[model samples]
Structures are given as structure tokens and as C-alpha cells.
Target chain A: MSEDHVPGFNTLSIHAGAQPDPTTGARATPIYQTTSFVFEDVDHAASLFGLQAFGNIYTRIGNPTCAVLEERVAALEGGTAALAVASGHAAQLIVMHTLLQPGDEFIAGTQLYGGSINQFNHAFKKFDWHVAWADSTDVSSFEKAVTPKTKAIFIESVANPGGVVVDIEGIAQVARRAGVPLIVDNTLASPYLCRPFEHGADIVVHSATKFLGGHGNSIGGVIVDGGTFNWMREGRYPTLSEPCESYQGMVLGETFGNFAFAIACRVLGLRDLGAALSPFNAFLLVTGIETLSLRMDRHCANAVAVAEFLSSHPKVAWVSYSGLPGDRYHALQQKYCPKGGGAVFTFGVKGGYDAGVKVVSNVQLFSHLANIGDTRSLIIHPASTTHRQLSDQQKTSAGAGPDVIRVSIGIEDKEDIIADLDQALASA
Target chain B: MNHDSYPDAYIREILDSCRVIAMVGASANTVRPSYFVLKYMLEKGYRVIPVNPGQAGKDILGQRVYASLSDIPEPIDMVDIFRASEAADGIVDEALALEPRPKVIWMQLSVRNDEAAAKAEAAGLKVVMNRCPKIEYGRLSGEIAWAGVNRRTVSSKRPVLSGGGFQRLGLGKGRTSN
Candidate 1:
């Protein structure tokens, strides 16, 4: 409350959404492991149901521990509010459910996580929500692809595996012109590296399992409402604007103000979908965020060194990392994420698929895994594992070619990472 | 919402994309925040028109002052509200009534109105309540540092890349032909 003092990033990371427990004086946020909360009286219960006041009624809809994690991530991202969900994919489902009705269309960037590509291409078809793919590199493509039914535009702040930084501002403009909100998946570039809200994003999502959880110990995801989009605009998003019959005809946007979208996702999406994040996972994620700034700084530093090493290596065909001076997305990185281009990037092996497979099987320090943003180095041959089911064209479009080997640089000493990769490359 | 600070990136994006800004509650007095905000926006290459009933038929910052948003002849991309929070409703209503309604409704610092904001948003207009465009633009554009004051964050120059066959993901560029 001091007028002169403004909390810095480190301070906010530690104390933004938490205070000493009033009842027990616990400094750290305690995991309220119960399924429900006892109401003060019938009036208190009714007020909570009516959205007259903010209180925990059920763990599935809301929880104290998860609320702290939500507030912490929201503050970190400068978002109006946040909701923690079961996994990254669950977060996407909640967001899409809130935005799309049957037959509504949304634009998505081609360069995205393979799982997301699969989700958008196949699973969403069943729901009757169509996806129109656009090139993230060309901002105009988004405009060209827009139809009257387009409800949103989605892209990754820093794409997975390939470490390509997107033009969030450019696409946001297209979304703005089309009367749609821009959603950016900030899984790779956490708020420490890039805050999508600052770049005109209306909504931001994260796979807390990766960087925010930091240790690969938990599976979690979050949706942050930038509170920039107008969901009530001409009734495009009826779930938020129209009166909800489920809740006695309450209009969420009118009642919640700037945070309507987040409220809708929680009360409707999570409540019905039943993909709520456990309180235990929320506690772990909150703990992980305490050291996010420190870990991300080291991750970027190590990644830059590793990228430089790979780009110059004789056996490496090409390296894709925006932190590299000559990389294609360097300009985007500088403009969007000046801190660094993030820790994960991909490089091609000279011997193609066989060499790529050999490198992943050989690395000692870098664990061969399907995940990124771990505290310890991790590597995977996407073409052989994650993107294996896709066709050659789909693999290429997603930046997972047969020769590509992705590396997620950790906080390890840069020399050890490079030496491990060098040994793996020599073996290949 | 906190009136003191906002996400800097959002502010800069709005400033960059918007060309014509209609300054509501514009004043001819040089010392007022509205006058300076209008002046600073003009200096930043935005086509700012002054909207003040009292200043009609007069010039502020060398641009003719219009009585209200309806009086402006050109399309307005942004409507910067410099009046008190109480006056926001009428201004927003007027903004919404325009033939080609403005895309954004920006309330100045210390001016916050949830009702007006919700109304504008329902009509498909972006709203920034309790914030100032001039201060945000100066802060994010790195021009405020010239006054010898340091904000926690400052803008950095965009990266100049060494380009030749550099493509994202090394997997061809642009969309594939249908």
C-alpha cells in the first residue's frame, strides 16, 4: 500500500496472489484438499450461487489453493483473471468451448504444437467448430481467411520445438479488424519471456506442466483473460453475452465486466467438462512460479549458447532459434520477447531421419522425452515420436521434419549441454 | 481495476494501429492534460481532432475543434475520453451512435466507469478504462526517459536480422497452393 514502492517482477512472483493464512498463520498457500467448502449460512450459500460475492463453494468450480495459482499467473501475465485446468489440452478445450458454438469458425496459425494441430483438425470437427488455418509468418493470411463466422484467432507466442516467435501484434490487428479476439498460447515463452497481453492478445494460455511447474513434476494448464475482448459484441459469443439458462438467466458479460470470458470458462466450461485441476497440482505450480524468473533467465542464457553452437556445427544441417543473430524469427524475437527466444529449438541432422533418431537415443545429459521446459535438458525427435502419425506434409508444416531434432535447453551449464549434444551428434 | 498501471504492450499496439483519434473534452488551455495528450498524439503522427463544444469554431494544436464526435467528418478509429468518469456514459453513447462507430473507447487516467465500459464492449468496441494514452505511449516508446526518469521497463530497438533463405521452422515459407 506504500505510495512510493512498486513491487518488481521477482517480488510479484513470490507474493502477488498470496498472504499469510488468516486462520492458521501459514505463510505458504495450503492445499485445501477437500471437495467442498462449508457455507456460513443459507444466505451466504445463496449469495455465492447468485455471484453476489466471491467465495469457494466447490473445489471443482473453485478452490483456495487453485485461486492463488490463478491470481499469481494472472498477475504475472497482467491479465484481468486466470483459471487453472487439468492440462494444457484441457485449457484449450475450455477456451474453445467458451468461444465457439456449433458451426462457428476460428482461425489458427499453422505453426503450433502437434497435439494442438491434431485437436484443432480432428477433435473440433465433432463439435462442428471449424478451423481455418493461416500462416503465422504472413499476417495478411489471417485477414484473407476470415469469414463472417470467424470468432477468434489463435497462435503461439513462441511456437513449440522450432522456437519460432510469432507476430502477435500483427495478427491481433487482423483480429481487431474482423471483430474477433486474438488468443495466444504462451506455453513456450512464459510470462517471464513474453507477456502476450502486452502485445494485444485478448486471451493467454499456458501449459503449467512445462515452464510454470519447472520440474516436470505436475500436469497443469491455465487460461488468462486479458479482459481486452468484447465478448458481448453483437452477440457473437452467446455463451457470455446471452442469458444463461443454466444459471437462472444471468448474463455473464454484464455481471462480470472485464473478466466475463474467464468466468464463463469456469462456470460453464470447467463445471460441465469436469477437467478441473487438482488442488495438489495447483500448489505445486504455485511453488514453481516462485522461481520462474530465475529459471527462465538461465534457460534463455543456456539456450542462446546452445543455439550458437548448433548453428556452426558441421553435422547440423540448419538450426532454428530466434535468439540466433541470423535466424528468420530473430526480428520477431527482438520485438516480442527481447528477454530471449526461449529454451526450446530444433536443428536438422546431416543423415536425415536415421541420424535424428540416433541423436535422441544417445544424449546422456539431455533426457530423451516428449516434453519441453523442464529444469533438466530434454530432447526429442518429433518426426519419430510426437509428430510420427502425421503425413510428411503435415509434419513439415508443423516444423517437425524427418531430420529435425528438438532440444529444450535447461538451466544446466551451457558447456555440458553442448558437449552432450556433440557426443550424441558424433555417435549419429 | 488499478488506475496507475497497465500492460505496456497493449498500449503500444493500440497507439501503433490507430490513426485517427478523437479527443473528447479537448481544451485550448496549454497546461491541461487533454491539451498535452492531443498535442503529443499529433506529434506521434496520429490524426487527432479536438472534440469540445466550448472550443467549437476555434483551433487547438492548429486543428479545428469540433463540437462532438458527430461533428467530426472523418472516420474515428479511437475516441480518447479526457472527461470525468461520470461523463463517460453520454460520450460512449454518442460514440456508439456514429455511423461507423469508433473501434476503441479509451478513458483517461483516474476515469473508470464499468457501466459505460460494458455498453461499449457489447457494441464491439475495445475499452481501456483508468489509463492515459499519452503517458503509456511515452513510456512504451522510450521517449519518457528523455526527462531523466526511469520506468521499471523500457522499450528496446527491434532486431535487425541477417536474412537470406531464413525461414521459420526451415519448412518452406508462406501457404502451400491449394
Candidate 2:
């Protein structure tokens, strides 16, 4: 009832940007399963198109269903605005597209999702947008990677496959000094564990397909604008600072202050790139988010138990779960994700690649697939699947080495999860 | 006066009750934020007096533009500062000096001056900083949801179209309208 009363994480996850349906009185966020919305008049239509008013013209750019998800995630992340998109790759692409020009570059931590490393090193190069790789653990490496051509710095809150908890604050300082926005892929931590914005990230990205849509039934991503970066000052990001040619020459930075980046991505990137999240997927993702805190709590607790079980196993050569006290990232895990080490972590098999494949084949309860952050336990030999495109050195740097087996611990009882892993390890 | 956050009631009361608004540093450029915001308020049926030294005695969106807040002949209900933070200090002083001074001092987005806000609050004026009124009006009115922005309030109330061709659910508390 009071505006001063800010909503808590769990409360916002359920109701942040939603209201009962005005026309139909639907209680749950009904999928407004339409491609376009009708305008009030010609003037209204012009205003909506000209950016003079806030109204939906097409589902490609904005939708009521997607808007609620955007708002919920934004509130959870402590960001000003957010854009919901098709996938994590789409979110990354839209963000980079908005920030970089043909020759411009961005710095990314080497310890990232294998797909992201591929996207940065291979896919982004087609646009002539270069990515300078830096070590996620070493903050100085980010500073050294920054060149005059650098427009942004990218890192994962918790590196995928590797289970490395990055020093976001340390790297954020490097980003601040370089006068670029720090883009953190918070796919694993899921706001319940690590809020990148709280630690000085300028923009927070999520692969909602994983933890956010806990059921693994949907594929969606979100880009939350922290509203901290100034895009207009030096004319560095012309997409925001300069007059937009397509949209009545409205300089988005001046027109939509604080939330300008989100607007720019929506009007420029999503509007053009055409990778949009379906309303049904958005509804499922939002529903999945309702129990995010509950699922994440159980997932982390089970993960620690699984990590402990694997670390003591004779068949395991080494484990990379930050939840373990002896693990190298324990201190950082404490600092950033005190909740637990997170749901996913990796361990090396004694016999390397062949043994890892055997473990995947032997697991019964854990689904051997290429995904994380699902309510169901998933196992993958990333070297043979997700990271197969990368070179051997690149695979090791990404924590997807030939010997590594990654498991996404589920909300299921710990005993069942550990038994499955135990039987799988024995066979290996 | 914590400018960090504003209660929904505090903002709603100002938008619903304050009828006349004087937009300081109002721009003529159509793409500028001040221009569209003024247009939005005008269309929302509020009497908005544009204050700009560069374009005086002319009209902005058909409202007679005044050189300053002091030059406006009629009583002003609120002074929306669209200028930089440094310029808001002088505008607040000017608003405070006016006879029957305005009830509210609203600074536009990205404009924050704590000292000026404190000074204005000392004079019994309500202050809102680093926010957009058009955004708030649309938000409180629940019309911003039309554009995919988070309206932040959930309610059972349905929207009713106004004579001016817009829906005003008003604030979320079931209080119909001003």
C-alpha cells in the first residue's frame, strides 16, 4: 500500500510488473497471444511509432506478457528496465549490437559459457565486432584487454561449466576505470545467489531457460539495464547518443534518460533483429520464477552434497564446485553467492575423455543433456558436446576439458542425486 | 526528504490534484524529452505553462510560453524542472519567490540536487527527483503497460476510457479519479 515499501525478492518474483487483466479480469497473467495491438487513433498510432507515447505496436518489439516478465526480472535485479528475448545468445547479441559498431570491440572473461566464447570469438567477428579475452579470476587482465576501441566489458557472475565465482567488484572497478559498462551473464546465480547490479555491474543478462524457467520448458533471456552508465557523454555509443535514423531522429539517451539503454535495445535491436520471446514461453517463465527462491535454495544445498560426494570419490581426479571448503573459489563463493555454490559444478574423471563419456552413459537419474538450471538434474560431457567447436586449450580455459563432467543438481532429495552419481562413477 | 524513493500515494496526490504545471527549460525540439513530456501532460488535460527564456511570448503545443516562472501571470500548481541539476537550484529559488508558490518541485530524470530538494521541502513544497512525470502519469494511470513498461502496481480495477480517448485506472487503491 505504501510506495516507500519496496517489494522483497520473493514477492517481486510473483507480482512486480503485473496487474489483473483490465479487459478480461484474468487473475493470472494471460498470454495476450496477438501479433499486434490496435491503436486508439491516427494520432495515437503516430505517437506510439514516434516514441512520443508508450504503447505496443507489435509483439516483435513489446508485448504485455513479455513486459510483466521484463519488469519482474528488473525489480529482482535492482535494474531500471529490462528486455526479454528468445535465448541467452539473443540477449548477448542484442546487447553487443546496441553497444558496438563494425570495428568496435568488447572484453569478455575467458571463463564463460562455451556457447558465449564461441559467440564472442566466432559469431561476433562476422559483424567485425572483436572480443578481447581476459582471465575472469584476474582483474588486471580485464584492464589490459581494454583498448580505445573497447565499448563494453563482459563476464559471467558464475562462469558456466567451470563453476568459478568471479570477483565482480574487482572486475567492475576495471570496467569503471575504462569508462565502459560491465555486462554480467547471471545465468547460473539467478538473482537468488548473486545480484550483479548490487556489486557494480552496469547491465545484467540472464538465460532464463535455465534457473529462471526452472521447469526447463521454456527458452528465454533477459537484459536488465542498471541505468548506471552514461551513453551520451563522449558519443562512444552512437546507437544511443546520436539521433536514431529509423525513429524520427530521437536520441534515445536524451529522450529516455536512465532507462535509455533498454529502450535503445528494444527499438533498435529487438525491433530489427527479430528474435522475440513467445508470450506462452514468457508466461511459463514467469510462472517458473514464482518458486525461484525455493528451487534455488534446494538446488544449492543438493549441489554442495553432490560436490562433497564427488570430491571424496577415488574415480574423480578433481572437483570444481565452489561450495566445497577446499575448493579454490571458496572465498569468492562466500563473498558473492553465500546461499551455496549454485546448482551446477564440474569434476574431472580419472580416465579423462572416455571415462567422462562412461559416466554420462551410466547415470540414470541425471539426464545427460546440454543444459543447466533446470529443476531436473542434467549431466553433460561438455568437451564432447557444447565445447566441441573450441580448440583443446580453449576448452580447458572454459572449464570444459576432456576429463570434466558437469552436473546441474536438481531440487530432488540429495540422497537420490548422490546415489545416481555414485553408481555412475563406479562404472567409470 | 529521502529522494531515493517516493511513495505511490505522494506522487499520485500531486499528479491528480496539482492542476497547473510550469515546465522549466521546456524544449521546442520535438525529439527532446521535455517536448514530449509537456505534450503528454497537455493531452492529459492539465494546464501546462512552458517557461523558457529562449522562446518567450511564443507557444509550445498551444500553451503560451513564459520567459520564467515569475513571468507567468496565473498561479502555478507545480514547477517541473527539466534543466540540469545546477540550473534546478535557481529554478527552485524562483518558484519559492513566486506569490502563492507552487505546491510541488518535480525534477526530471537524471536531475538530482539534494540541497535544492531540502531547501524546497523546507518551504513546505513536495519534491520528486530523477523521475519522469509522463512516465509516472502513465504508470499510475496504468497506461504505461500499454507500451510494455512495468506499471509496478497490481489491482482488480478495470480501465475506463476518458472523454479525451485514454484510460485512467487512477492509482491502484480503487480511488476512482481526482
Candidate 3:
């Protein structure tokens, strides 16, 4: 890599955040596992604490290993800065904490991960924050739901459980009109597949536990600040606009300029909330992201084959994969994620709930687990598992009807993955 | 943006120096968080003027409600916003247009607007976003320790419960035994 030559996505994935370790020249990002960093001198410590210089003070605030992961993801997503947290949920929490005030409201797409629905519907209410549900399929619903109190609009890039591709640009326009930031959960369609920021999203969150980690070994989340939203434009976000009491009258937005939101999340939200990502997890995620482009391509190809097989199968009542031609979200898939509609998709079995359970239990190669983005195929009956907490109507709206079976196609042989599903459906 | 965290010493400096506040987006509803925070600030000796277009000509927490920040007669030291994050921009613009202008713009907990904060700071105003002054007062006065939220400061001393009641801790430094 050189200053003159621009690196491609694959090259940047491996080299963007990393340089030869200054101390030991280690090619791999060394896990700075300890809790604190040594200061050069009294002035250096003062400078760091005073925001006069940039350096690690503690693992809870920042770390070398984690910094690399953050930089890599930021580069991958075309964002100014990124903050890594304990899990995908933690990332959303910090982001909302930075944006939503008690009694403030935000609009959310009805079609979201079951866990996200729980977090927004039940948990966010505890903070006095309200959520207005909107239909992702109908962009006008989002525009209609905007109120003077609406702070943000949230949607998943390729909605979980079902492979429904969202119209990111349409919703982004609505957010723009309402003077709110558009937050996109890019967990399913990693940057290799869809870059939400490029389309109009101001912030992108990832369940690094999924595609970014690729291996499913580490639980991590990331927030990429697109650095596009004008926090000072309307004075809507006082957290970034005003002097933080936590730090003497230092105004984060005024001081940090474009990416002040990220800084606030780090100093204020993460500092107080304590959902810091471990250095070991950062190291593992960095390694996994290195092969993201390669794995994602295979994942998409395998998923298309599996979806086609399922659509024609006698046991499957319907298949909801955007990759398939004539699917409802096929045009959206072409517009948003031109490369692929991602590996995850949903299909309803003819035998309903009982058959859904049988198919999940009968799978051999595809592990029946509460996870996705694994190198190995995975399956789940969401009605009885991931979406169990949701109401019946919620389950249906989220495309997790009782008969729906979700699959995360992996980078395995297309025939093997299809064969596994064939046997499972036969048993059902 | 990486200006870093502000220490407790600075926080104390700002709190110690500030006085009269004009609350933007103040609501008349008793259950609203803005109403309670306004009530708390008023009880703390800070003269607070509630600003809400809908509540204009009415009284909330004993203060006459004004339609906007500019309509308030007195020179306000701080403008505490109780509105949504998107509303802060226009409020900041209005605050900046005032003759003396507010010395500080404090957004309630979870309200943050980076752009508005920058403009205010550039014009020599201090801004605090996504925080509650009532919560800060309680934590700084060592009054919230009973609920176990103030981790930055740890004192073995038990907090004094004011005669006015424990809930009034958001008011001032009167409740702490320390």
C-alpha cells in the first residue's frame, strides 16, 4: 500500500488499520490485553487528559487493538470514525443514548431483528424514549410518521430473518427532511455487500458478532459515524452541542467538529455505561474482517442456489429471498445491494410450526443455533426461538410467521448446503 | 471529533458560576420529565422561565411560560432544552440572537446536537448536551449515592435526607450530610 495508490476493499480490509507494530514489528495486530497504558511523562498525561493529544489512557476508554478494528471498520464503511462495543445491542444503546433525550421520540422500521424490537419497544421505554413504528416496505410510511419530536429513523440494510432489502435512499431522504439522522443496521449485509453511508445513512451499526467477525468466535458490535449529520446545524442534539458536565465545559461537537458524536459516545456513553469491547475480541474480529469480501461472495452464491432449491420444493409454501428473481424486494436488492442480497433468508414450511421445528431439528450440516454469519450453514425456527418474545402480530410483520424457517447460508459447497436442507425438509 | 472528557473540577466550575436559566420546550404536563426538572431547578434558587408555545400565558412550577427564548425579559444565564434533538438547532439559533445571549445551553439527558453546540461555543457560549442538570446536581452534591449511581466519587459518609424530602435532592446541595 502507498500514499499514491488507492487500495481496493480487499486490500484495505487487511492493511487499512494495521501497520508493522512499532515495538515488535508483529504483522498481526497484537492484543493489548492489559487494562492501562504507560504515559511518557507528566505533560503527556496532562495533554492526553486535556484532549490536547491522542493516546490511550485506559482499556475502558480506548485500546490499540480495538483502535485498529475501529479504523478498519470505519474505512470499510466509508465513515469518519467508529467505536467498538461489547455487542451489537450495546452499539445501538450508546448511539441512542447520544441522540435521544428522555421523552424524545424516534421512528423505527417495523421489520427489524426480534432482539432490536425488544430493545426499542420495551427497554427504550424505560428511558422515557418512545418509538414510532413505520413500514419499511412503504417509504411513505416513514415520511408520514415523522413528528417534531422524532430524533432518528432506524432500519436494517437487509432485514434479518427475511431477505427484504430496504430502500435506504428513500428513507434517508425522509430523515433528511425531518432533520434527523438515519441509522442503518448493517449486520447482515456487511460493507462488502452494502455500504449504507454511501446511500444516505448518517450512522451505520454492525453486529460484528456476525459478518464482520465472520468466524462467530467473538461477540462484538461497532458504530461507524458517517460524519455527515450536521449536529450544529439545528442544535437538536444537545449532548454534542453543549458543554459536557462530565468534562469541564468542553463542548464535544465544537471541539471535535465532524465526528463529535463518536467522541461523545466514547467519553460519555461508553464511559458511564461500561459496555467496552475486549481487546481479544477486537483482535479476533480484525482477523475475520480480513477475509470478509471473499467469504461474502461465496455466502451469496451459496444462498442463491439454496433459495432456488427451496422455492421449488414441495414442503416450502413460500420463500422470501431477495436474491431470487421476481421476489418482492428483488428491485431493492439490485438497487441497494447489487452484488448480492446476502446469505440469510426466510421460508414458510407447509406443515407450519411443527414442521418448522422438525426441519431445524433434522438439519445435519446446517447447525440449528441462535446465530448467523458463520462459515458453516445455520438454521432456526424464529417463532419458537429468536422471535419468541414478540407478539403474534409482531412475528408476522417481521416476517417470522410460525411456519417461517430462517437460514444463514455459509461458504460451503452449494450441493452440500442444499442436500442438508433437502434431507431436513424430507424429514419434516 | 476528539476533544476528550471534561473532569469533575471543570464541571464544578461551570455549575458554581451559572445562575438564572430559561428552559426551552418546558411542558405544563405534570408527568413530563421537563416539568419535574423545571420544578427542581426552580426549587434550587435558579429563576427559571418556562418556554413552550403551547403553554404560553400559563404558569408551570410558579413560573410564567413564555412562547420562545427571545420573549423572556430577563438576561438568562443558561437555556435548558427539554425538546427533541432536532428542535435544539432552532432553539440555539434563537438563543444566539438574544442581546446578551445565554452563557450556557444545557440539553436534557439524551438530547445532543453537535452543530448547534459548535455554533454556540464559537459565539462564546458553553454547551452541555445529553445530560440533566438535576442529575448532575444530585451526583455532584453526593446526594444520588443512595441509589448507587455516582461511581466517580465514593465517600463512606451517609447522605443527609432533607426535611423537604429525599426527592428534592435534584434541587440543590442542601440534602447531603457531607
The two-chain DockQ for each candidate, comma-separated, is 0.02, 0.45, 0.02
Best TM-score among the predictions, by candidate number:
2
Per-model root-mean-square deviation over C-alphas: 16.6, 2.4, 15.0
Q: Write the per-residue lDDT of candidate 2 for residues A369-426, one digit (tens) a residue.
A: 9999988999999999999999999999898999999999998889999999999989
TM-scores, all candidates, are 0.73, 0.94, 0.71
Docking quality tier of model 3: incorrect
Clashes of 1: 1
Q: Enumerate residue pairs that collide in model 2.
A: none
lDDT, model 2: 0.88
| lDDT, candidate 1, B29-134, per-residue tens | 6535576577667755689999999989899979999998999998999999989899999999999999898988999876888899889988988789876676
- Between prediction 2 and prediction 3, the one with superior TM-score is 2
Candidate 2, residue B131: CA error in Å? 2.9
Better of 1 and 2 by lDDT: 2
Misplaced by over 4 Å in model 3 are B1-178
Q: Which candidate is the best by DockQ?
A: 2
> Residue A130: error of model 2 in Å?
0.5
Give model 3's share of reference contacts: 0.00
- The list of candidate 2 runs beyond 4 A from truth reads B89-100, B112-122, B145-169, B172-178
